[model samples]
Target: MARNTERRSALADAGIRVLAEQGARGLTHRAVDVAAGTPRGTASNYFPSRDDLISALVGRIGERLTPDPTRLSSHAARTPDRDLFADYLRDVVRRLSTDPHVPLALFELRLEAARRPAVAKALGAWRQRAFEDDVAFNDESDLPGGRTEIALFHYAIDGLMLDNLTAPIDSGLSVDAAIDELVDRILR
Candidate 1:
């Protein structure tokens, strides 16, 4: 049977919520069905297997975390400089933190990947493509950084998001200040 795109998206989103709240072990098909408010086996009917469900989650997270194209293009039109880079990074973080469940579920999947190769395989490929897309965007926009610099920013941004979502080491520390510092030190 042909799967409904909307239903699949909803199920995957529900899976994200389940993963965020209950971790990988709790992300069963029934759990996703419950989260989506669908009948029993709805998620399984759509996904067919756990791996398929995970692949859908990875795809949906990419959609959720993607930068808004309007904002992205406006930033791209800016004169490339450290300030612009910092602003771009700020937007990236804002998108990441907009939905608490998206990042929380992402971290949960990353941790689960250590034991489940299926998760690793799906997430790894998705992350690599995302990295390449970032590099391409930076290059096309004349952003003040090379691929290595972009990689460093990615690492820093992930750490910053993790801190914000989980528990901050210093609650009073300024994320903006940290982003500025990263741009100042990494870009120029």
Candidate 2:
């Protein structure tokens, strides 16, 4: 069972790389097999159809993007202040900037989701998980506005991340500064 889990994880990672490099049109069982460096037919054995593979890939991306509970707990325990929240936002921006492929693949999946119902369903669930996590984090930190604040925060961060990833220009303000400004506006 563990071996199967590992293999599935490897295939999912390969699928992400393929999606990043080749886009949705290029994501296929055979392509994933080649990217994974495994024998041919491995991806097919795990994910029987394109929708299945896409679904798995969506889950995999969520896993990569979401902060672990332990990390969240440690951060909250250390200092549940606005500064810590700003630091968390900075880390999020840093990950998006440094690991461009992950977001690139995610964007591809999002575009694909428009045309594929299964992919759309997976994305919806993934988004819900993120929303829930944000709510929990806000509650734990004793932040105001509850879900409304989280909704705005997510929208702002999404825009910032998309802009930063697409056309990163030195606008005199660092990413950290931008995050601080946004967080302040949202939390205030």
Candidate 3:
């Protein structure tokens, strides 16, 4: 069991390193094994299937990169400060933008999953779970086309993150302005 854990950890680290250098499309079990200083056969011993390896790599990447929504929820509950929620989201976006490797890998996985129903299902579940609690606070209860408004809100925030990734130095685009516009238009 200890050996299995060690190998898994090593493989994950190797995966991250290779992903950093070569991006997700370049990821291969043999490449990870070499980066991990393990025998060529070791990766297959640990991950007999491509899906298993990709799943593990994806999980590891999420562990290292994504913000924990539970933490955000707990913090917001404890503080009762709306600004804190905004700050939390801002920090999460900043991390996503500045961390080029993880964001790029996640983008790659998302694109790959587009044609794979199972992968898309898993990714969708992850996204829903991550954002559902915060999204509940969005107050789209009575507006006309509320569902479409909610979807557009999500789309705008995602677009902001993409913009941030490209222009990491200047995100003067006010999140406050975006949120206010959303509230005025969608929540009225």
Candidate 4:
């Protein structure tokens, strides 16, 4: 069972790399096998279809991107709410800027999900889980406005991420400044 789990994880990681580098068209079972350094037919054994593979990839990407609670708590211990929020946003943008492949692969998955119902269903579930996690995090932090604030925060961050990922231009505002502005608006 452990070996199976490991192999699935490896394949999912490989799929992320492939999706990032080659787009959705290049995400084939055989391609994942090659990227994973596994023998032929390995990816197929785990994910029987393209939808299955994509579903797994979405879950894997979410796992990789979710912030670690211990790290968050440590940072939160010393900072106030607004500063903590800004710092969290800064950290997310920094990660996206540094390792663009994760977000790039996510964009690909999102686009592919549009034309594929199975992928769309999977993505919807993933999104719901993400939303629940965000709500829980905000509640734990004792942030005001509950789910509405969390949703707005997500929208603001999503816009920032989309702009940075798609049309990366010098907006004349530093990332930290933009995050501070956003934090002020949301927390006000």
What number of backbone clashes does candidate 3 have, counting pairs of residues 3 or more apart or in separate chains? 0
lDDT of 3 at 188: 53
- TM-score for all models, in order of appearance: 0.96, 0.89, 0.65, 0.89
Give residue 70's lDDT in candidate 1 (0 to 100).
94
Q: What is the per-residue lDDT of model 2 for residues 1-188, given as tens digits with 9 covering 90 to 100?
A: 12498899999999999998999999999999999999998999999889889889988887787675676676767656678877777766665666677888888888998998888898888888889987986787875547887788788777777777678666787777887887788878
Cα lDDT over the full model 1: 0.91
Screening candidate 4 with a backbone cut-off below 3 angstroms (N, C-alpha, C), the clashing residue pairs are none
Candidate 4 residue lDDT tens string, 77-106: 864467776777777676666667788888
Best by lDDT: 1
Predictions: Cα RMSD each: 1.2, 2.2, 5.0, 2.1
In model 1, where do residues sit more than 4 Å from their true spots? none
Clashing pairs in 1: none
The stretch of ten residues in a row with the least summed lDDT in candidate 2 is 90-99
Instruction: After superposing candidate 4 on the true structure, give the runs of residues whose Cα lies further than 4 Å from its correct spot.
Output: 1-3, 95-98
TM-score: model 2 vs. ground truth: 0.89
Runs off by more than 4 Å, candidate 2 = 1-3
How far residue 93's Cα lies from its native spot in candidate 3, in Å, is 1.8
- TM-score result, candidate 1: 0.96
